[model samples]
Target: MLASLLDSMADSLVCSVELEKTKGITVRVYNESGKLTQTVILDGKSITIKSQGEQKSSTIIQKEDSIISEVKGSEQTSTITQKEDSVVIKCKSFQVDAETVSVKSSKDSTHESGGKLTVTSQKDMSLTSSAKAALKSTQAMDLETNANLTAKATQNVSLSGLNAELKGTTKASVASDTAVEVTGVKVDVKGKAQLTLEGAITSVGENITTVKGQLVKVEGALVKLG
Candidate 1:
């Protein structure tokens, strides 16, 4: 019967996974006078549990051929994979020392954050972060794109461009349509500070094929003075 209709549609997507998806998961042990009794729930999925105080507990359930994701209220010693289309989540380590975070999507979606992710996208967005990263648009033809960035730490970075760049010191701020390049050097003149524009900037030792920052702003004369 065509393998019984593909095993009844894979057992209706693995029994529609429910059991309140394991509730109130926990782990805690303290004795530094920061008192708060013990609590633990290690292994409970598609849940059902009954444990109280002076904690120490364990439960297990496994069925191979893939499809597992239902862990709630903390303590997830990682491994989540869901397939009907594609989904794979593997974690050997994940810590959220949480404070506040949020996410939502209706159609197109791609979101990632190691410890911090806050997104409110109505249309287009590509945000990647290691720490300090910000992009805000109020929707009039909204376009924001960032392919890569890596920063170890050191503040004061802004790019509100018609174009902007510096792929080396890790700072790329662009408000695109024309020009923005750095590290290969070329940042088409605009109110200078550590500036660069490989063609002209005259006087103040004029060989400046374009390197300004002690004061530089070239727009139409393109700077020329030997």
Candidate 2:
């Protein structure tokens, strides 16, 4: 049996130069120059591949069946997006490009969705102390981060009635120091027309309101308002 197996193997190689694999098989690819190209494994159903130059397994997709609203359909939705620092997934369409990546579900428009956008540095190199010591490499973007507008789902929009509560956390850090400084600004709206500021009120006609007010001047500024 061992001699026959080796003979079969020799015959198979003589037949075709390209590698042949079946399900539940593992295959590794090498470039013509003998560089590692990719490694793939078939786990009875799906094929997973780790490509060259990629940090992680580059691609993994599974095929399955699904049952929808009293009917059965092919379970055909899976997406992964890795932008600069964020990842988002929506539906059937999923794309990972240079800056922002998103995955969308084509089944339902308003169903569950996930999305992430990276608004910071795009450097691909990781910053390590030893690596930096060997080669003078500047530090990458600090982890300390903050977003200007952060809000949870609100029940309704406040036109001119009561104030809505907005809550979030913040962290601030420059460079070289691990300690972080945090600050927050809140615009609390409590009563009807209670919160008002006098910067430069620009409007079409006479803008007057009987409430807490400040001196109004709009003559010398570059832009004027009524």
Clash tally for model 1: 4
Distance from true location, Cα of 73 in model 1, Å: 8.5
Off by over 4 Å in 1: 1-60, 67-109, 112-135, 138-226
User: How many residue pairs in model 2 have overlapping backbones?
Assistant: 14
Which runs in model 2 stand beyond 4 Å of their true positions? 1-23, 32-35, 54-57, 65-226
Q: Compare the candidates by TM-score and give the number of the best one.
A: 2
Give candidate 2's error at residue 183 in angstroms.
Answer: 44
Each candidate structure's count of clashing pairs: 4, 14
Per-model TM against the reference: 0.18, 0.22
lDDT by residue (tens digit), candidate 2, 1-226: 9999987665442111234355566666655343335666667665455555322224544434311111112454444544454455546655466766556664534433355434455564343443224322254433333434333434532323245333434533233234333333632335454533333443332355433447654445376333
Error of 2 at 29 (Å): 0.5
Cα deviation of 119, candidate 1, in Å? 14
What is the Cα-based lDDT of residue 13 in candidate 2? 20
